[model samples]
Target: MERSRYLQVALEAAHAAAEVIRHYYRDGVEVSIKADATPVTRADVESEEVIRRAISTAFPDHGFYGEETGSHALDAEYLWLVDPIDGTRSFVRGYPFFSTQIALMHRGEIVVGVSSAPAFEQIAWAERGQGAVLDGHACRISQVHALEDAAVSSGNLRTLAGGPRWADWAQVVQRVARIRGYGDFYHYHLLAAGRIDAVLESDVNILDIAALSLIVTEAGGVFTDLDGGPVTLETTSVLAGNPRIYAAVAELMRVPG
Candidate 1:
């Protein structure tokens, strides 16, 4: 019920990865394409390890689900979701928007989340009742209710706007006020800060969306799959937006593949 300790540790883990990830990112990092066609890197792996060690030592009983090493279940009341270096593609290309995400979910609900974008020197986090915060300031979703006036974000145009799936993506963009391509998980934090209205993207893992879900929800936004279903570890596509436009946005992305 209390969020103090969990949020503290989550921020610590996220900041730890944030610091190390910065160094490897200076000259850019190497990338490896996964069997699923997703990209990973040494920076991503090492960052994941850093968070894993921090979490394990701080809360030995807490379970962990990481992007790199997969899942480690301790069967405890709490689960830590981690994305060591979210946006390995951007990181590999020397882009500055990638981040490290950490979250604490208790009994199936995400109660705490920490996302650190070291490149930007910003940290965004949330606790269920505490609301979402950017740095130390309270954050909220945009009041924009009309899609024609909304500012939107997506991970990558090439990845999300190409192939047969592009047809599904095109429909969503057509209805938005403007589409800005800012790849990586950092966009959700931006959405929580009220800087963006929504973020739709494909091909992700639990680690990618877990921390984001708490941040957005506590900030008065919604996080769900394209079809408006609850987000889960198995979900690869995501639709996140402020409450007013979430359902409308979700409906637009529901076209079957």
Candidate 2:
């Protein structure tokens, strides 16, 4: 695997943010509803602050787009995408699945990523051409190519039901062998670990998908938006998995004209 200084910086930032998340985890951290109706906690803000400071100190001119702090230098050639605490609901409930995700985008392409789950003591990271690692071990996606033999997961059903593609998504559920709603950062971890074949989710933000996108793809999996498009800041949905499974799911997820 190739080594990179920037990837190291991303790892350091993610680890630094993890400490803040652990401090507030299940400690009655206060939460507020954002304008988008999503929950944000003190941990989220503090964690994002930690990440921003770490990265900026290392690369002062790099842009940052964080879930809590919003965007900075959006037009800069280098952009750091941060999701301080993905699955905030799970964090508030003391669930172990929430993760801190950080990714570096160079000229609009994500080049490095880290997904650190504080409670689980697990960290997954990847750099382009460096493959991926989970908890110090090399990672790879499952080779399961057949949908009928694949275990699938999605973002919460209620969330998808309210979306325009619910009917098309349902077709995916019927085609796969098993389905679980193990939404958020954790699902990508599972996909990279070869524990599941695919994950389909809608209404995702760039911060929610950036890190996991690189991690999964580097782990020999595919990552793309719901329509089989590239995952980007404008992406509102995602369908990710091993190459074949991704193709199958994306086909099933396409809404009819």
Candidate 3:
């Protein structure tokens, strides 16, 4: 497929998601937990239906994966990843931080990523060779080079509960310049747009980070696991940042807290 087609797929997926999600705006829909214990809602299912149908019709042979419904294992030349409503909890509460994510991976690399935050009234997207853009303006990561100087964003503390990982998380949080608990894909969007420096979170699904991993990298940031390897669907934790800030924070990661 042509590179421009990647953008087309991503954008259309985002638009489809936004249209469904808007039905819940202001006074929002109630939420129920999925089998995995993560929240799901009508908005989620509605958006996923739109996205999945579009993907199926657009590329009949392509492999598709999403959060609401799991994925099929694939080594296909083209794979499309979707997160209908990435921040379902936030969506249930009518918060604007929630978003829809769509990505295209060609031969194991993310060639295009589109993130649309309807409440935020902005779209941040990018492709493998082209640099990232936000609201149609080109953007880059901040030039900050030191851990102490970097502004950090993280997920909810509850995601770290039910384990000894909380101690490790606390230790890592204390080392950062500042910590904001803006959960979901918005944090990564901020990082990509250079408004935030780094983000670390755990217990995420492949659909949650699939598009984001590429968006960050195209914006001149690094997307990796906490240990600094490539961002993977199998990873339980993820660390993403501008390259310089990532290196500094990677070294600050706690060992056993």
Candidate 4:
């Protein structure tokens, strides 16, 4: 019952943020660089504000960690992680890849999540125990067990390309039946919906993928950092897939031989 309420609030917040994003997306907005050199626009800021307001109103005591608004009461028992526009670059350039992400973390474990891509007309959500849903239908992962038979996707591999894992990643790329770079919320959506078999990323923040982690996991997929660690506030990478494919990828990532 409590999880349902949290999911409802999260979905509402995501919808509110999507409205704000769509408004600016249609009217056009200026972009500015953040301290980390990433692009930000009015849609990003305003959408985050809309989401923050919606969530805070429902759970006044819960904490918030938004990409644009910064953090508030992070140590609180309940924390909402938000990325109003996860694909700011794609959004700034008039693409349809951006989305609003919202996830509730209770005691450091994500309990509810909602990912809304207004321009793409896609919304995915999940609760800890309840199944994941894309649009209005329940979603699940693919059953492809072998890397040679799996369709793989990669996202933001800048860090991995420069690190020791590049060789291992290359080997995996060579083994996969297919490879695509549907970065941001798209690949995870595909994975959860069973349209893809695996996704790899080496550069992401909790705000960007926290909601996605829960969505994929609830859909019967495994989601963790590139090192096979659980997703946390400090997570910066991803290695997610169905049970068998996930194990194969994790092993290949560790020892390409």
Show pairs that collide, candidate 3.
none
Provide the TM-score for each candidate, comma-separated. Answer: 0.87, 0.94, 0.89, 0.97
* lDDT ranking, best first: 4, 2, 1, 3
In terms of lDDT, the best-performing candidate is: 4
Per-prediction CA RMSD (Å): 3.1, 1.9, 2.9, 1.8
TM-score of 4: 0.97
Model 3, residue 106: displacement in angstroms?
A: 2.0
In model 2, how large is the Cα lDDT of residue 188? 92
Q: What are the per-residue Cα lDDT tens digits for candidate 2 across 156-233?
A: 556678877788887888889999988888889999999999988877888888889999999999887766678788
What Cα-based lDDT does every candidate model obtain? 0.80, 0.88, 0.78, 0.91
Write the residue-wise lDDT of candidate 4 on 153-243 in tens digits.
Answer: 9989999999998999988999999999999999999999999999999999999999999999999999999877899999999999998
How many pairs in model 1 have backbone atoms within 3 A of each other, for residues 3 or more apart or on separate chains, i.e. clashes? 1
Superposed Cα deviation of residue 149, candidate 1 (Å): 1.0
The alpha-carbon lDDT assigned to residue 64 of candidate 4 equals 93
User: In candidate 3, where is summed lDDT lowest over 10 consecutive residues?
Assistant: 248-257
